[model samples]
Target: MKRRIAVLLAGCMVMTALAGCGSTGGEQKETETGSIENKEVTEKSQDTGESSGAEDTISGEITMWTGTWNDGLMDTLLEGFYEKYPDVKVKFEYLPWDGMEDKYLSALQAGAGPDVLDMAIAWTIPYASMGKLQKLDEYIEKNQIDVSDYYEGAVETLYKDGSYYALPYRSETMCLFYNKDLFEAAGLDPESPPATWEELREDAVKLTSEDVYGFGLCGSNAGNTTAQFYSMMFSKGVSLLNEDMTASAFNTQDGVDAFTFWSNLYLKDNVVPKSVLENDNTTNRNLFAEGKLAMFVSGSYDIDPIMEANPDMNMGFALCPGFEGKTSAAQLGGWNLGMSDTCKNPDAAFALMSYLASPEVSVDFSSTFSSCKSAVDNEKYADEKLKVFIEAINYGVPLPGSPYMNQITDILYNEAQAVLSGSKDAETALADAEASVNKALQN
Candidate 1:
């Protein structure tokens, strides 16, 4: 289970690093940037188009590369692909997560990369900037594929400037998971979890004991820490950067408050585990399952693992708590499939991608793999546990599409760690981070 958690974190942390590096067939272009928003798109109002494949025979062989899902799952998914286009052959390979960027960039630079690539959506901007990914706007328009049919955040996560390079394959959002037994033992209502930051702090104090901490916070990985921090800041209306993405905007009062909130949880209260300094989501999940922690913030991905680890442990879920009047926010993270600009068989590649993103397949795939609101609405597939995440997705916000994404993550992680360790105050830490990040953005 620890190994699995490590693998998941490894894949995500690279989203920032991999998004910053990578070369393509053409020179890199400057991308337009936008601020992250907590607003949700009106459901079912966005037009989703039909699949683009024509009835006539369109046959060509294509290769695909994905990091973790096994061949069996791919085989099952591609069963429909093969059935739809009997003449198209797919050579699918399970690419090891380690050094995937080097392998991919090397292969792509050598003019020998897979026809279709599945990667974290965070990589979409850099990959497209390098001209390694095929633009899907024309294909989408030609196919009449309604981009709105998917979660707005998942769909918009791939868009940079005015183009989309990939289609959403899977998505996950963060939520509050509490130990019901701990709540009851603390004399709090087991059925009602924290609904605001003050409530969360109060509950944590009551839940804390010599053996069990109240919260499990993550500060180890730059990407994970940045994500967790962003959710907190967003809930208070803090923006990572100003609109147009030219400079840092998180050094304000909200930023200080957000960092202070977490730092206080660890330092002032001692309710969060000290291991948070080096803990990843997996470590936190394991601790929660072991009954060492009462509550934590995480994504839909941990559901199966927690259930597998402690099937009988009573648990509850709720939206990530925010201030009384502020909106709750969660980070939208996921994978997307994009076509290589140099692919010889783009039609075939898109045919496969289109099938994977189709309505039926999207809902079916969500049953065991991903979370999308349209799919989760089906009672036959999802239950209350999954629905909590689905509702959280409605309040989801994406990380900004900046070329210096990796630098931003590092700045936030380092400064927040400093504050949590008592080496600096939240104001000074964020001020230094703002200066460092502004310098990076200038370059």
Candidate 2:
């Protein structure tokens, strides 16, 4: 199966490369002047039923800035795109994820940003609000692409005030991953994964040992701990805002209850280890793989490494458990592709975007990269472990994508962490977060 997929991807890469060669012939004509005169030609072609091939005749170079994939896969995908449209030369600049936001914002301010950009779906709203991204509604409509095929949660993250500014290349959601071997040793049912908060707490207590932790909840200063906690809040029907992105709603009873639940796991239940207070996502993952953790919240991408590292360990996954009567909730985090407002060849850029967003190409990307959804429905790509992740998306929500989201998220995490460590009570912690978030929103 892997070999067949690889062969098909290689063929697609070659075809894409050939398209790039064809586009190179017209690069001179397209670059002779600034401001994309080809837009007018493309508009005329639209009326005449001419295809993207006709638009390819007018070409100019465009740069693409990306931060997601490692060098190997990044080079392959970019090379494939370059092969498809040689006329529209792409200057690919890979950015490190750590300082990407500042770098992108600085470039935008300096008026020297890339013509094609990759960003997390959560960053879409802030960038679009700053007028740094091009609105792609017309381009999408012109191409007659159906947006419904993409995961609904992923697609919604790219919209602001009814305008589409980005298209997701990959989507991800969290799930509860457990060690089957640990479950059996603990005298618990290995196949019966926890389905509720109570069940999870009970299982954790039963699984705890001197050498192994019952659960690995990353409570360190890492950003994802806050994200994971926020998803739990959502499962209890709490939200940061009241759907309008205008006010603080996270201080409600549901929010306090959720925080208290996590706090008790550390202080009273004693199921979670003290080491979790200093661990990040990688640390937590490594602990689980090393057999020090019985269970942890993990994404689909963690499967290969964990399996490879511990060949004899029986790993399993379940949907993130729910609160009371609520359904399980997972948080969406992934990258989206968009044409820069400065793109010299919008027509060609749109064409490339359409091809990349097609179901066929998306399926191949998901298979190769272990991503959740590209253009294909996630179900098509699911194995047993992946199915748990797919199931979680049904109730998954995108992170709050407001311009003030970053600041608010920081406040939320700090206050919640204080409560978890017993430095503050739940009521005081939530009140502080509410005040902080409200002030940030006002500013």
Instruction: Give the best candidate by TM-score.
Output: 1
lDDT of 1 by residue, 300-371 (tens): 667777889999879999998887788888766666788987899888888888888776675544323343
TM-score for candidate 1, residues paired by index: 0.84
User: In candidate 2, residue 287 scores what lDDT?
Assistant: 86
lDDT of 1 at 26: 23
Report how far residue 249 has shifted in candidate 1, in Å: 1.9
Query: What would the TM-scores of all predictions be?
Result: 0.84, 0.82
| Model 2: per-residue Cα lDDT over 1-443, one tens digit each | 00000011100100000000111111122111122123434445557664555545746766667643332344444444444454555455766555666677677756777877766666666667667779999988977777876677777767777788887656667788999999999999999989888798999999999998888776775366676677788799787775666678988888889888877887888988797668776677788999988988867767877888887878889988888688898676666778766777787677666655566655544422222244224455556666666666656677666666667767877886787777999889989888887786665
Q: TM-score of model 2 relative to the true fold?
A: 0.82
- Candidate-wise lDDT, in order: 0.71, 0.67
